[model samples]
Target: MTTAFDTAARPAAVPGDTLVLAGRPLRDHAVLEETSRYAEDVWVLTPAWLRADQKTLRLDFTLVPPALVDVAKPLFLALLAQDTPPGELPLAIDSIRTYFGCARRFLWWVHGRDRTLRELDGEDLDDYHREITALRLSGGATRCNRRAVRMFWAYRNVLPDHLGQDPLRRSLWQAWARVHRRAGGENLTDRIPEQVVAPLLSWAMRWVDDFADDVLAARAERDRHRGPAARGP
Candidate 1:
């Protein structure tokens, strides 16, 4: 029943106990202050700003099957801790939530089949890919799910229980990606016509060139009119 926060295996604080978070030196206390494990299966992560609408980014592992939860928790905890080596970065809360969705979908699929994650082989992955393809999900959605499955292999060294082999090492994946338009595909976003873009750019330039100075001056004047107490530090 040991949670991430109470785990004895948690890494000891490094020298100076400093973390470079959001381009600033964040002390250990500041990082822990924003993260809390409310239960064995739920973690609430708050960003520094703590916006009202996004007060917490909750990762609830209870949605994962009980048999698989032990294996899943460590992977997520490592990700939440941002334990990557140099040149790698931790995912933002929003990105982590997206990954969680992908992971949850895959875990539920495995659970439905009465399979354990550790027992998943490359063939099992291929069948899973076929299942995902059968769903007719958009190319992006399929890729996200595929990437989540591959994550178990990619981060295997960090996880106590992980896939024994690379899921993407097989040639079948390349064939699947090509056949499904999942690889080397151009962005499908509709480009705004030049006719529409030209007017928007012109209006933006006019605001910057003709109106920005006046707006800044008004703001400065308003700030100046405020008493020192009103502008208290």
Candidate 2:
């Protein structure tokens, strides 16, 4: 499956159906503010997008939240606090922390930092943006924030004003460049302390691979010492 076709010769192409928006920092700008969890936010847009595109091609946005992963920490603790098998905890944490975690952090941040507790609507998200843009998010974190915020607003129910209805959300940037700069801002990915990749795998894949190898080697060595079993015994 890992086949490579010379991409340069194919004439670069950007999908018109794919619209990418930049994410805001969850704690966007302020150091004091924490990050958000946008775990369910991304999927929340599915129905709306389906209604919009219908055919030609399905449209989707892949949000990249730089520092939004910490949101999974609570989920991890939640799992640990439960009665799930200890053996299962590590595997669950691996997926929760690695795959959808950043988006989760973005959601956690906006819910926790930008909007006041118990209040999901009626706030000026733009000010929140200004605030987030000022603080330090880990690499590609800002995009996570902005994308989550926009998607959250897009999915949230709007309140009725005396005159009409207002949008429940806002966007950090209309284009991708600003988003890339803000989220991928600084090499924050590196800022996240390098971890040995194998050390992580050792907990599962490596250990199992090692155990199998040891078992096979032990059997071979025992057979070798037996001198072909000396015919019939």
Name the top lDDT candidate: 1
Backbone clashes in model 2: 28
Instruction: Summarize candidate 2's per-residue lDDT along 58-131 as a digit string, tens digits.
Output: 11123433333232222333332232332222222222233244435445555456443125443445555565
What lDDT does candidate 1 reach at residue 177?
A: 72
User: Looking at model 2, which ten-residue stretch has the lowest summed lDDT?
Assistant: 156-165
Q: Each candidate: what lDDT?
A: 0.65, 0.36
Q: Which RMSD does model 2 reach against the true structure?
A: 20.0
Screening candidate 1 with a backbone cut-off below 3 angstroms (N, C-alpha, C), the clashing residue pairs are none
Could you tell me the TM-score of candidate 1? 0.60
How does candidate 2 fare on TM-score?
0.26
Each model's TM-score? 0.60, 0.26
Q: RMSD for each model, in Å, please?
A: 13.9, 20.0
The clash number for model 1 is 0
